[model samples]
Target: MQITASTVSLTVDDVAASQRFFTTHLGYVEQAAAEGFASLARSDAALDVVLLARGTEVLPADQRDRHASGLILAFTATGIEAEEERLRAEGVEITMPLREEPWGERLFQVTDPNGVIVQFVEWVTPSAPANA
Candidate 1:
């Protein structure tokens, strides 16, 4: 059996800004956009997002956290430090420092302007030294 992750849903407060961030920084292409929603695609992967304008919903502001916690979405990176530096150069906030974990993965965290946390990780794989 085989499984492939294709899409996920994210709630953002701004449509155009989020779209720009995703397309410009994350390399996602816009597949669709509407009054308050957009679907962006990244190569074979895609994200289904709904931009909820202020005062359009009836729920209290605090309740939004109910489903927003503990979701770790990781994007594999070639050089975690290099990626971190590039993002920092672009004026994006880096919430966590890059560090190698006990599991041997170099990982870091960044919170998007809309409050979504993105984790960047690169697996530790041994290979012949560059001099070889």
Candidate 2:
């Protein structure tokens, strides 16, 4: 199957908060919106983001009441340090300070108003293992 686009649908308690965070900080534009739903798009990628109000009828019966939890929406980014600084200057709290792992992944995180965790990551060349 050929996929032309992708989207992550999140059930949230406050659609407006998620909508504001995406559009204001993440460079997403609204494709569509209604009382309890929003479709967001970005020019740089095919990944779209959809926000649905928790308990809204638009979701399946079994999923309607569930809010997004234990999920970290991550974006692979360049110049992560600069991005982190820019976000900090914009008053966005850094839930996880920028740090690097032994495997060569640099990342940081921020939590949106509704408690959704968004992370930015950058990969660097890993050092050769001692036993390699």
Candidate 3:
């Protein structure tokens, strides 16, 4: 079987607080939510995510190793610069300014309030070869 997509699960300290930050700041729509868990999706992409409850036995026994660099999600965008500008204007903390990579990708990054880093990229040229 071929793998389709991947999902990254995050254990947040406060579900409602994080939910609001995602919905209001990042523009993610609530797909599902409860006291213990929540799922949200960005209106512009197929990316979906779920947030798990923290501070329980279900949580990892070791909390000292928790980190922000643990995960990085990359997304494709149509207008990289404009989107970055908009996000910056809205107070989005840009970790890395937009730059074109040697592989022809214009990309930038931002971190959510909970410290989840997301990278957004737009291709500079068509990359599709022959087989589709």
Candidate 4:
């Protein structure tokens, strides 16, 4: 099947809070919104996000009471250090400090108002293997 786009729908206690966090800090624009839902899009990327308020009718009755948890929404990025600095300058708290791994992944994270962990990662050349 050919996929035209990708979207992640999150059920949160406060849809507006997550919406604002994404738009204000992550360059997303509101595609649509209502009392209990919001759709966001970015012109530079295919990532689309939908926020549904807990207990909203849009969710199945059994799922309405559940909230999104234990999830990390990540973006593969370039110039991760610069982005981290920019976010810091904007007063966004960095929940995870910028760090690089041995296998060549650089990343950091920030928690949104509703506790969604937004992580940015950059892939780099790995260091020489210890046995190499």
* Order of candidate numbers by TM-score, starting with the best: 4, 2, 3, 1
Write candidate 4's Cα lDDT for 1-132 as tens digits: 998899999999999999999999999999999999999999977579999999998778999988888999999989989999999999999999999899999999999898989999999998998899
Cα deviation of 113, candidate 4, in Å: 0.1
Q: Name the runs in model 1 displaced over 4 angstroms.
A: 1-5, 44-70, 125-132
Decoy 1 TM-score against native: 0.71
Task: Kindly report which residue pairs in candidate 1 clash with one another.
Answer: none
TM per candidate comes to: 0.71, 0.94, 0.74, 0.95
Off by over 4 Å in 3: 1-6, 43-45, 57-69, 126-132
Judged by TM-score relative to the true structure, which candidate is superior, 1 or 3? Answer: 3
Q: lDDT (0-100) at residue 37 of candidate 4?
A: 95
38 Cα displacement, candidate 1 (Å): 1.2
Quote model 2's TM-score.
Answer: 0.94
Pairs of colliding residues, candidate 3:
none
lDDT of 3 by residue, 12-89 (tens): 666676677678766788988777678888756457777776654555678523443478778887887988898899
Which residue pairs show collisions in model 2? none
Which lDDT values do the candidates have, in the order given? 0.68, 0.93, 0.75, 0.93
Residue 83: error of model 3 in Å? Answer: 0.9
User: Compared with the true structure, what per-residue lDDT tens digits does model 2 show for residues 17-120?
Assistant: 99999899889999999999999999996469999999998678999999899999999989999999999999999999999998999999999888899999
Of candidates 3 and 2, the better by TM-score = 2
What lDDT does model 3 reach?
0.75
- Candidate topping TM-score: 4
